[model samples]
Target: MSQTLTSDQKDALQEVTNIAMGQAASTLATILSTFVTISVPRINIPEVSEIGSAISKMVGNGKEVTAVRQSFAGHLRGEAIIIYGQEGCRDLADLMGYDEDIDQSAERELLLDIANVLIGACLNGIADILQTGLTFAPPSIMAERVIINSLIDPTQLTWNNALLVEVNFTLEARNFSCHLVTLMPEDSIERLKQAIDTFMENF
Candidate 1:
């Protein structure tokens, strides 16, 4: 089933997402000791078959990337995937005081660390705004040095369509950037709409 959101509902979700992403950006700034900027959140409901190409375009087609995946469950349920370009990874490692020749394990650790921070902070912010709770699975390296187009196999997804929330965080000075894509299946989207409705009632 398709998830349809009214205009006001869409606006409400966007507002909450903006606040949540701002919190994520603040956490990132604190960690990197640099200013971090976030793009306005974009929300879409795309067919599973198109998810791979949609994300590929968001991260840049053909770019080799590393990704971390974390699943959250509770009043809201979804998977948060963080995509990092090669330069972004190197910049992050440098910011974390890694040597130029850091080992593979160390790099993976760095990726997981930052991904956990951003995803946790962002999702928690959303939960806070909605006065709900969410628990996250440990972040795992979903793909290492894989091209964006190949990162996700749509056939492996159980759902035919999903509500996708996309946002980007950039440390401009360091030229480091990552995209956080949150996917919620149909049932979760229905739950989210009800939550949004409840949230708007108070305003």
Candidate 2:
């Protein structure tokens, strides 16, 4: 895997997401009738093996997670996404008065609805500023015991290696913490730098 985004580039990334995440927080607050606090976005680019474990550690058990993937092409090119585990979703659901007795079977629909709201709000903010359009595959879930690689389609990857940028976030209602991860090609580093620089100029 190639580490293309340098420190400055990474900072630019976090800054861009800071604005988007705040927008997501606003979206959640209106729906749940509560405030949502977003932490400072941190940048993490992970290797193949590190991806699972690092992600596992971030969004531990007993939390609801929403994972989103959107490809970004421009001066800064890569996939931009958000991943929120069960914790925030459950808390938000509770706040919104959703059924508390959700089981494994019901999770399929539950997760899709959550992903639609959270990821949609986040990327909408991003696309508005970047003047970019993003495409998405339907969001799905792997059960509690499943490995991420097992569920992901292998054909989508161009190589054995991948570069992923992860930003940590905490939702305020009940202190739900999870990750927002973005993946991209090694060649996209330059584009990332340019995109960040552009965002910062306006910021």
Which candidate should be chosen as best, given lDDT against the real structure?
1
Candidate 1 lDDT tens digits, 22-123: 877787778678888888888766556678788887789999999999999987787888889988888878777889998889889878888898788777
**Candidate 2 C-alpha lDDT tens digits along 1-203:** 45546777777666666777777777766755676777786656656556555555555533344554545454334554445554555765565556878564555565555555555555555555556666555555534433343324435553323333344444453776545555555555444456556876875
Clash count for candidate 1 is: 0
For candidate 2, the TM-score is 0.66
- In model 1, state the lDDT of residue 71: 91
Candidate 2 CA-lDDT value: 0.55
Where is model 1 more than 4 Å wrong at Cα? 159-161
Question: What RMSD, rounded to one decimal, does every model reach?
Answer: 2.2, 4.5
Question: Each prediction's TM-score against the native?
Answer: 0.87, 0.66
- Identify the candidate with maximal TM-score: 1
lDDT of every predicted structure (CA atoms):
0.80, 0.55
